[model samples]
Target chain A: MNKHPHIRIDRYALVRNTVFVWLTAVVVAGFLVNIPRINILEHTARNLYFHVPMWFTMMAAVGVSGYHSLRLLQTGSLIRDIRAMQAARVGAWFGVLGLLTGIIWSKFTWYVGTDVWWNFDPRQTMASLQLLIYGAYFVLRSALDDPDRRARIAAVYNLFAATTTPFLLYVIPRQLQSLHPGAEGNPAFSDITEPVMRLIFYPAIIGFIGLFWVLYTQRVRTAWIKYRVIRDPEL
Target chain B: MEQEVQSIQDSLRAKESISTPFDSIWTGADVPTVDPSALEQVMLSNDKLYVVLAVVLLIWFGFIFFVYRTDRRLSQVERTLEDRIYERDDEV
Candidate 1:
């Protein structure tokens, strides 16, 4: 009835359209723009534009989710709780996509002529572990029935989950031996990655993160509407 | 199709002759090597470009699925709103 004071639908529409066009351009450039092919990587080096962005988007989602969870703790606002929950849900989906795409990329590129689909590469394993941590966050939310109690407890758990994400996705993976580019003793993006690839890669990251914002915000809006009508925000 | 497959195989063989930094990492003594299966053969073709295609498609599908789920939530909220309106009309 109050026109949903917190959300500006017009602004959301503008962002949604921008993300749609931006990502379409990214996908086109991602394939059309050529780079110097390497021995194992070859054209699959283009995966830097697609596969890597999933992780970056997931990281951004985690940051958004964590910030909202922190606010939920401080403000005791149900809207913040809804936002934090939706962010984590969407973020986890991105992580799952990242993991699956990584598996596919490695299957053809790294594990070619081999029977391996999953060899437990350090980064791959740690990424899956990070997803499981977010998985626990969802399960924890479902366990609590009272909205306020659920919000408080889930926010605390989400913060803990967010804290582990950096370590699991970046720190631990870099510390261990990994086929992933940024591992210890490996030539990272700065050294081996081509400038042409970076041209598409960075934009791909921004576009995917923007896309995440669109999806997450849409879910939050729907959940907020449910809260206004039914007094429950879980969707 | 056969010629295309042959060209891909020739290119793959040619690539094996030249050593790069990745070769050292991927072909380490500890690494196990085996024959590629049919699925691997298809994916490994065209400089493994199909792998990039697969990755992109997977992400696209993932987003589509998420969108569908959000639409479902919207429908549920709309139904609830409709029910509430009907209840108020009855009260009136």
Candidate 2:
């Protein structure tokens, strides 16, 4: 246990508790803080604080996962493999949440009259595609029976998946026409979006990313314990 | 019908005062743009408060799922420890 510092339960409890309090404050501030209403956006404009943070969190998660995957390839440390997998898993969940939130936001604000839930918007489509790439990374892991081989192969695939995430979520989506802000000459957060909104929005991103860290750390700790017991760290 | 007439008059006045094409086109259309179902009507009202409810509920369910998964993993870890303890007792 002393040799494996990653598995040791150190100040994780303190950080986890702090994250819980921080996110609670963010949610409260998110709803209570007044935002200048746009005609179509109305109250749904508030979603910018929540929905946008999810992608930021996902990107942060991807960074963590990819970093660990890189370390795993370099050192072949089992803990690095576990960290990579858990981060990707948690990141994918955040992506799902982001996609669902986006659908609900767009349905009312953009598709109010059409009764459409999914309109194949560029950003939405690319986000789904990005998730699929990560999905393949998971499937690739399950296919391998040997732990060492699985880690090596999955790490490579995870790196690939992470590389493509930014393009799929940000670059390509921006290249095409999208209802999402900052798409096709539409400024992302121009003066049109009130500056006051940033008070809640910036912290919301940090809070959600903090939330991601807490969840990812929990899963990594569990996986590390399981690895010690079973000597196979595939999960 | 009155609301529709009022919408038309509002759009006409709005068009004269402001030429925001999107708003005017939506309001100026001869046919009503939407026939929301009862569920949609309920959800769409009050500035779509129910949409917020739905988003919060979705997040709630997602957290619930994470809780369940964590609980299951804890049980598995507990079972492993229990098995090891039983084996130690037998050895003694």
Candidate 3:
């Protein structure tokens, strides 16, 4: 049996089980706990536990992807390249989820009377742009025939993409006038947030990030196997 | 010690019994007899808790779908290797 030192299945089972239990508890607590309803927000405030975590998980995934990319630049390890690519792909999914969920939330809350599902909210636009950058990274990879050359070029582009992620998701969105809560005023976690909601909110973020880790690890292991058998790691 | 515990429980009960203005307003409101819109009927019921359920389920199913796709890839690789093994046996 050909064994790769980096790709181990032992840790995944334990971590996957833990993440499953943690997220289940998060869901129960998220629904069962009662939050103080405010005007406009109403019960949609429950979204605080779900919608916000998608961004947090995506940001964490970006950090993981960038770290692996930097390692690839240093060592030129194929494993590092595979890890970087898988992380970015999974992270992009999280960003897509965040955008879609935000649309659904706004449709009910802000666009109640109007039929506008895709208002050009600053955060929404910036996030979509960020996903596009990652999309270009994948396109750039596919355009290259040589694996070594592709990994090097994609790593450089991924580093640039990672650097822009924070600016696009947080900084630029805040500078512009927007309906997202934190943009115009104090950050979302201010005096108004209830202590009870925080109980589930923080766990939800951790659980979703944990979920990201599991998915990224799974893809990396599969890519490693394909790399060994078929000599192609692109997945 | 038993008496002390009983007293603490009694105080908690007393706290629950004390009604505030918030409780009064919530209790005094009439249940709506008018028909709710379809969206409201599905999403806004039970304090709009179903919305949270919807979001959670979407994420849950999304992750499940990813796992299934990855499993399929693994199965494909396994089949390819198995085919190669059969070809080697036939040659022998």
Candidates' DockQ values? Answer: 0.10, 0.06, 0.15
- Candidate 3 lDDT, A137-199, residue by residue in tens: 999999998878999999999999999999999999888888887786645666668999988
Tens-place lDDT digits, model 2, residues A1-235: 1433774444655675676678767776776677777799987788888999999999999999999999999999988899999999999999999999999999998798996999899999999999999898989999998889899999999999999999999899889988888788667876567877888889989988988987888788678666766873322
User: How many Å off is the CA of A1 in candidate 1?
Assistant: 4.6
Calculate model 2's interface RMSD in Å: 5.7
In candidate 1, position A170 carries an lDDT of 90
Give every candidate's TM-score on chain A.
Answer: 0.96, 0.95, 0.95
Q: What does candidate 2 score in Cα RMSD to the true structure?
A: 9.1
Output the lDDT of residue B18, model 2: 50
Worst 10 residues of 3 chain B by lDDT: B23-32
Identify the leading candidate in terms of lDDT.
1
Best by DockQ: 3
- Which parts of model 2 have CA positions greater than 4 angstroms off? A1-4, A232-235, B1-92
Candidate lDDT scores, in order, read 0.83, 0.80, 0.82
Grade the docking of candidate 1: incorrect
**What stretches of model 1 exceed 4 Å from their correct place?**
A232-235, B1-92
**Considering DockQ, where higher is better, how would the candidates rank from best to worst?**
3, 1, 2
Candidate 1 local lDDT, residue A212: 92
